[model samples]
Target: MILGLSKHPSDESIVEGILAGGRKEHEALVALYKKFHVSLERFIIHRSTGRDYAKQPEDIIWEAIEAFVVNVKKGSFTLKDATLETYLKSICKNLWFRYISQEASREERQNKYMAEWDKLEDDVSDMLIEKENWENYINLVNKLGKNCKQILDMRLIEGLSMQEISQKLIANGTFENDQTVRNAKSKCLKKIMELITSNHQ
Candidate 1:
């Protein structure tokens, strides 16, 4: 049994302990995980059919628990209408659905990026074919940043999908997640276009 916790702590107490933070917070988070992880895992696995989850059910549940902790601390979660378990499950479901939605849109996003690249290539076909101009263009891309250059190289040169670039960036500890990768890619592409336009001018 965890010290400073009752045999069966009330939901209110658990919430209070989590908000209080420190040791109480730690204990409360452990308690919450112990109480809900299995149920949430089962919930996730049951709904995971035909979905490509980047994380396992256990990882997703733990991620949900961590998000719940942050929400509770930030007053985003209040145990007013729903029990802790119900509220947590809601968070898990929302997170799962959002992840799936992102996965579903990946192909569409990849096509859009490819179309944009194709248009850019058409616009600068003459310049791009010249060796010196191509080198200068690459130099402009390299100025964006290490990660930006890598992302563009993978997406544009290697023709990798955004999801693939996201995984690589995350693995390298360059970006936090796929959404961040998308944002960075968009910005990098825009910057490249501006640079190319200015360079030609």
Candidate 2:
């Protein structure tokens, strides 16, 4: 009936077709879209009624389908107690929630960065009386210890969050946690202030 295939292919057959690849994979994907697209679209629209999604409902459904196909091919999707429909819906929900969380987190970080930058400028301006003194301040920042310099550069120059900096440091076994990065960044700022004050004295 659909794509010259049976009216309803069993879930096992669909999985097999997808794993087999080539024309079978293409047919399987088409069949899946035909079977579940409307229901999934309704579900997504219902769940995301008031939300501001960057992607449209159709786009999300397609993305979910692609993710499902990829997961099946990768052996990540094991239809145990749940049906294929259930699994696909779960993926769609998770993707949407993750997108929302990331957008919220990005906004939060931008706001925090702006506030911190404003305070930093105010503090530095008060300390550095002349243009040359500002140059001295930059030199002082560079003269900080390796960890301090890297953390400041990541935070100030690269605009990375403390959590992001922590992850990078943890990968290389430099620092343990975000709290540690926070402590180090604070110390770096204090050290700069001390150096600036001493220069004036």
Candidate number with greatest TM-score: 1
Model 1 score (lDDT): 0.79
lDDT tens per residue, model 1, 82-197: 89889888889988877767876987888897688656544544455553576786888878988878987887678787788899899989999887887787777778878887
Cα error of candidate 2 at position 160, Å: 30
Give the per-residue lDDT of model 2 (tens digit) for 1-201. 544568887777778888989988888888888788888888888877585667777887888989998888888887784788998888888877777678789889978965775576457556665545646666887788788778766766677877788889978988877667666776776677677777777
Q: Count the backbone clashes (under 3 Å) in each candidate.
A: 0, 0
> Could you say which candidate leads in lDDT?
1
Per-residue error for 168 in candidate 2, Å, reads 38
Candidate 2 regions exceeding 4 Å error are 1-3, 113-201
Q: Local distance difference test, per candidate?
A: 0.79, 0.77
